[model samples]
Target: MSALLGCGIVLLAGCGSMPVTGDVKAVDASQPGDSQVQVYAVAPREGAAPSEVVDGFLESMTSDDPDFRTTRKYLTEEAARTWKPSEGTTVLAKAPNRNGPSLHDKERRSTETSYRLTGEKVAAVDEESSYQPLAPTDYSQTLHLVRGNGADGKGEWRIDIVPDGLVLGQSDFKRLYRSVNKYYFASGRTNGQSALVADPVYVRNRTDPVTRMDTATQTVRTLLAGPTNWLRPVVDSRFPTGTALRKGVTSLAPDDQNVLKVPLNQKADKAGQGACRMMAAQVLFTLRDLTSARVEQVELESDRGRLCSLGADEAEEFASDNGSGAPDSQYFIDDKGRVLRIPGNTRGSGDPEPVTGPLGTGTVVMSAVGVARDEQHAAAVSANHQNLYVASMVADGELAGPAVTSRAKKAEDRLSRPSWDGRGDLWVADRDPDSRRLLRLANGEGKPQEVTVPSLDGGRIEEVRMSADGVRIALLLSKDGLMTLKIGRIERHGPESAPKVSVEDLRQAAPQLTDVTALSWSGRSRLVVVGKEDGGVQQVRYVQADGSTSSSGVLPGVNQVQAVAAADDELLPLMAETVDDGIVKLSPGDNWQTVLKGGMSLVYPG
Candidate 1:
């Protein structure tokens, strides 16, 4: 009668874990105490596994005593019942012991072996450790994992693990790593080996492991050898996945490591909207390569009911690399917290150019950098801000975007920000040297509408705007410091004819000192003007066309202002203000409201 005693591996050739599909069951048929493993000397180990290994590593963090029984003959085996032995038995199925002498490897590795006193079927496995780092974080080190049978089987090797430190921070990864630290065969379904899609084109069996994209020829190469599959680059260069932090990421690799700066997924469909998405995601999981979670571990969990989707940490694989990269993986998600696959990500069949629908490109365009935001639909000036711009961000009191239109200048570049005019015409604002011009990109004559507001140097344009009725245009004027608001019935004036309103007494300066700056059209005749009070006390006043005004009271502490717009109606009535690059929304409340968050613009186009 043949009884299964224990099991373990001799590791004649293969380097780590069970074959991609082979059996890694820790089942050895050997008897108690006499089992031993024999590995041929193909190389010597340069790095040692660790002292006390698993239990010791975890025990330090807990109150329980965690010491392994060195003399017990219980081998970690299969068909036996459990993974960790029953706590008391020498029916001894032993895992391969990492004593000394191994292949040269810098990757953190653990070898688990299982075998009995007399057996042939050995179960063994080898695993590499992972890490994590804080954003703008960059760290690199060479780790050596040495393992063998007796006291002399040691080998040396090198492996690169970026984001290697991430695993170090996660309690889950550490738990998972130690649960099966000492490598054994078949980590079971949930615990089994995971395959990572290391590069952009590695999707089929026709290719091996180390696949390469030739920078020289722009061609791709695949590495083929024993057990063959390598994704090595022809010149070994990489492109950044998003916005590249030139100075920040330099520390991640040797000065020689090529910092990848691939054409941003949609570099400038409209977000920061010109250059590209930073090589690193400002949120989480910026870098996209093996150093991070590799393809298999970066899943974008979509939230179906919500506008934005949630992404899997360093665990789930991304479905594709189209519109949303990084954690914006979810086109949408279901209520169960599971990722609901979106349309473009067709089961990841590898579609390169997913068509861009009406939503502009799903690229990071202009992120609100100021402390101003509007209620879901706040009506903005309907003009692209160009006068105050360093970048398309509200740095001081300015906002900006790169020049993308035909009138673009290296300096005063003009990007077309087309806001519709209830009519089929597109409206755009251009800030020329002395002209605050508004253009109709499409006109009644089938040409772009170009309306330039004559310079305020002659007389300041306290406020210039199109009425909600779409029938008239109102240009509030405060020639000097006093407010001399004016109204114009633009539809009757024709496009080329400029509307001018003058109140002789209104143009004259006054000692009252109303330094009006921001204007909100509350109604065709009523307006909200924010300015200094009698003693420079900041206040927002509601002014009626009849020249009578109501006090909205002092604006509290905030003084700096760029743009302010009111929401359309009562139900969705909203207000937005640009503080810096951040847009803050003024939630309706008592007299005045303090800024509660960063920002997102909500323009009520209707």
Candidate 2:
């Protein structure tokens, strides 16, 4: 008898449990050891046939033991010692084909072997405890079994050899796996301010045999792999491309003082001292979240010598380096398309005040507007969407430049909401059917400059928002008949007078979300998302940059949300436009507060 145990990625949703297919009676193969031990202890049935032995072995695979020592009872002595369950686990959509394990007689020998352990592999878990969603595929393994003498000297079936690790159904995987947050930094922040951006991903729980350091190593590897496709451009990693731990090293080794000694390749050694310290900061923040031990410091080493060492306290100095911090006031376009502002965290009923500009007079019907981080500038789109205007935020502030319009023929196909980066550069996406691209108005004025965004695949950008630190952008995109939330990093090259701007590493932030209507960054690495699930009602929720949700369920008080805005506090001074077009505000534990009767579009400074 041969058994194949393997795992793959891509598990389908809603596949709950595997029902028993045939009349194979469920056997209560209990163990003789202390029942209190937290291990899978199923004793082999005496005088049992090969098929019954295979059934008991499969049942033992589901136990949540720290080690598979008890599970080894179903195997021969040699096979028990040779089996390494931690190699990897294969999660299946359904239980294996138990009836297919064929037993073959040996020629004058007390041994028989079985063949064919097969199922649909959906997801996989590695020895490091990381979970990867994979494409659905069929998997088959062969198990070798032997007919041996039992403790009572009777004939018994025992598995002599099997593929590494265990195979489980989707239900077992859901019960065993957990999601955790890994931290990375935003790429472009002015003045060296850095903030932590959480990348949520799946991993094995503490009960798994994987140690804390091994789990930490998996998290580090993911971080080194860079942000997921959607978050890649919006965030930055301290470890440069091609920089990784020394070969043959699986986990980080920390000293008695909790100082993690990380050995990197030559690429890391070339990074200067300042760069090395920032790299250490990323490691410190990530490890702190994974291990209970105080990761007080990180010592980065290269083949040549010590590259740099960073103390935990030094991270605070670069708090905004990731472009996470943003302006706190909530700005919006009112019923008449006039620009207005409201105190972000106010409790009492507050009237929206018009800002200082032609936009406030309603002379120009404004469709959208973006407030700059300094609160001194504003980018406005006309009600027709044909023309874009930029001016000062002060009272009667003069126009910064002449009206700007794209070459597109239709108004709706023209510019999107205008956004401002830390350097005061204005950005807008032109969704013209004939010519789709992102245009920038340097310092919120002057002629339009085209910014290259790779792999957009001709999808129209519905809306774009720049981060406060000026290094990243969040996008609402309509591509291939689906609305997606994507993030990317902004790279500038050449002289300061005529810089070249390109958006690269574009990736989807919410791949499972089918109908994303509105999204805005609430923290350095967090966003308040409003969307609908497949065939579900419209809802609001919070998600990490890596596309994992930190909040439970959707935000309450509305059948559908039209627009959403966020500020960077824990309680999250969240505001949204309801299906009825009324504006509402949400606090951490409070119901939606309808602050205004009617509103157009709203935004918080990037």
Candidate 3:
């Protein structure tokens, strides 16, 4: 595994084989076409003093150019050619502190002054375009300014020394950069259906006139370049190794009919019709966020002829197989260890009923349980947390097979709540210090197969929840003694042979949050996270699958949140377990109503 350290977060990009082989077009420079043009802007205004020069340069780093060449004007001739903007970037929550114009040398009147920028670093992106969650910490950077003779022979400030990367405030960073997800194939299949995993990255937003089309071009270019450093290992892209738009074709704007024409080299023409469709699907999904409703189809063209075309309506067919609808019922585990169900639309009027199976008979003791997406199968952890059991939910059905034992020597370091994926696979983490691993059970029965997770270093997984799409997994982990929530991509290799599953590309969804106790998938692209920051009360908040918080307010009336669950129904019903073990339902307006008492391990189907 290869790793890139960011703040306190370490991103892992494991090595894996791309199972499918297909021809993809490479960018051809000889081809004639209308591509986006690049425009340069004037540099920052000249400053008279060292501090002013340093401040102006720092502010210019957030300019609208895809490259920081405009900002480079602040650097001296030597520094301009040596500076590397792609080295890495440090994202800060606020503007950096300006420390001093201290003299570089004490003898005589020093001609050089050094100014230091200090602030709280929130995240970092490496040269490979991998974004890592960073623990908030003081970050300091220094740039030396030299007094030099100007055009008129008067002294002017010029930055002679500085770091390679850029730094900007969180608000400015968010405004200037847009987050877009690239689609890749999941490790496993559901009902013989292939799934698409989402890999998100930040790009310059579409606010600049000179680089207005850069967003689409960069998004497509990055997708063709493959998943970011952290996700490169497990996931596979349909685009061939050399696949890309023709060299001069940077602007990929859609025509009047909302159709995008992506001309490629002849290699892409060799791809089979099916493979071509898959390639188009990847492009369609990645551009979906940027184009929104304007994009209706994508046509792949080569120097020879049109390879294939994919319509927005059929994108899901060739891309993700997560399904088109949501579940109609909410699910939970009662204090007595029975699986309970609540009609989503009925919210406050109905009494919860035990699921029809041995789980409802009160004969078994379960500490945690997960219902499959179909709601017909379930995997449960014993009250002791050392054993795992699988059972059917039919009326009067009994648990199947003996309980699976844990490898942990201590009882507390046992199995966590199991999660079911769209493929009907049950996943759980065994926290046994002696044999820490993630286990996947097929069809909720028998011994589990061990799956590889991102290099945790010393971190431990506390909970795991698979998205309804089975393309992502939400994890609450404890690293460096701090509880944090992260998202990891699931990659399955050699599907026809001995298929193997590995989790890689771990990134923070709520980097600003700590003491995350529990989390659950609330919607196709959203999660309900239960966590609190230092000196703050435990509360429930909604977050995107990528780890960004949603504007949806936190759940009310809870000092401590223990667990949460969301039904797939259109209304997106939600349930939470409080400190007292009472289950509360979140109303449409963020209102909370006690629905049941003595409820724990609340969960929805995979």
Candidate 4:
């Protein structure tokens, strides 16, 4: 690796008054087109000053060196042996500013010097590879250097005490790592069916420094490791306890036939054929977006031999209805306050037709609507926004009386838009000041049950959108004139006869947006949000469920966006209701075009 650094190198003298008495050059931090363009670590020259050693170590932390052997070269033997880069990662807004090398023990003329590293922390990645974006906060740490004996028999400055794990700038972190989703089954499935839930995590884009594995291999290993801490409460992994990849296996690739063969340890050898196939499904779903070569099949192997195999087509049995299968038809309320639909896969403002229901026939005026994942049932909020009604979309019939009603005097404080989960349950938020609560109806019909949200912290839920997977929910919370988007884990407890649902651990999913107006789940781990920064113009963009932002998140500018809707299938055009343009749709690679000149409240089935 050091030899590779010698080629295409640019060397410059160290600057500043920190006593950097060695060759220092700027690291190539440009965003590359692919993982092939990587920055390798340069070994510390002999007798490097304290500042140079500290700078070199920080630079090496961002490199693609497989094991960080070069990173340890700047540390003393004790520090090197004690350092653990895999413990966690601290991401900063920019490279940390170094100050000092002030003499300690001035009275005794000690050889030790200390440097203060400070920066603004932006996010953190735990050992489990879970990324959590945090409110920017001040970060401070100290690196102590001491004189040590060198192989040349001269005094050398090396880091003696350092912080555990890697500390990287946000730009470098993004360049070195990529987000990937691991699959797990939703727990407590009373029926004979199973659904895979996505657990997104970050991993090295190239080879992992600590694991010494390629991207695909690392992702599979993480899948076997189980779900993340926040998601573990509601999901289960098919992999048995202690199951792991076969020892000494560091790379995984698809054959010419696009089949990936994964060898597992003895723990998996005992799994039955059914369990083995489920395990294969988890791997296939997790790696679907990672590998350069498409994987058509997954064959699981054990110490003894092949245990079982699953083809890509067969893996659909475990697919989650949330974003799987065909594209969903877009729905909205027309100018006449009746529900209308745009057929799925239609392009350029295709003919809009009325749905086959009372809500569509104007039997009862409607303001908002949510269609079930199956497209069999639809829930509509009355024009007054005080009454909630559920009607069949397949069978034409008169709508029954209000299934759920809100008594808030002001229309703005009435019921919110309805959302249906993949489990065939309907969810809505009652914004009534005196009776503020989230309600859910089993099968879109029984008595409305109040879903507990214990972590609201005096804030009110302005809107609610349930992920199709049924294990997560997106909430728009309003407090002090600001609306923030938060993602909460949906936990179901007790027995199937009487289940208790609660939305817990509410965390900011779009902290960068000062005020969020509307949002919808666009993919497994992504959301299309219509919001803006402080004092900035209203705009549309995509946000990961984890709250991290990417350069490509921002969409082409749309004017006066009052509402936004995105389908789980990303191929469908993004629909939104704007003041300037009544309703507009943005296709995959095209600009926004008017869909309906008079429609409002556009949305896709949740």
The most accurate candidate by TM-score is 4
The lDDT per prediction is 0.26, 0.68, 0.70, 0.84
C-alpha TM-score for every candidate: 0.29, 0.70, 0.80, 0.94
Clashing residue pair totals per candidate (backbone < 3 A): 121, 33, 2, 0
Write one digit per residue (lDDT tens) for candidate 4, span 1-606. 456444533222221323343432223243432344467777788767778888888878877766888889888889999999999999887767776766767652345788888888989999999989887899889998988755665578889999998998777888888888999998888776588888989899878988899999999999999999989999998788999999998999999999999999999977899988999999999988889998999999989999899999999889767342556888889878899988876743678899997888987889999988888788999999999999988888888999999999999999999998888889999999999989999889889989999889888998899887789999999999999999999999999656998999998875768899999988677889999888999889998877777767899998989988888777888888899888998999999998889987788888
- Greater lDDT among 1 and 2 belongs to 2
Looking at model 3, which ten-residue stretch has the lowest summed lDDT?
11-20
Q: What is candidate 1's local distance difference test score?
A: 0.26
* Model 4, residue pairs in steric clash: none
**Across residues 107-202, which tens digit of lDDT does each residue of candidate 2 receive?**
633467675667777666665444444446888887778777656665667889788877876555544454566656665454345655665656
| True lDDT of residue 462, candidate 3 | 82
lDDT of 3 by residue, 131-200 (tens): 6657788888888887777676656767888888777666555655666787776543435566666777
Q: Which parts of model 4 are misplaced by more than 4 Å?
A: 1-36, 108-110, 149-154, 322-326
Q: How do all the candidates rank in terms of TM-score, highest first?
A: 4, 3, 2, 1
- For model 4 the local lDDT of residue 358 reads 86
Best by lDDT: 4
What is candidate 1's lDDT per residue for 371-479, written digit by digit as tens? 1111011112212333211121112222233322333342233322233322222344453435445454332123344554433345544344443333233444545
| Residue pairs whose backbone atoms clash in candidate 3 | 187-492, 509-547
- After superposition on all CA atoms, what RMSD does each candidate show versus the true structure? 29.2, 8.1, 11.5, 3.2
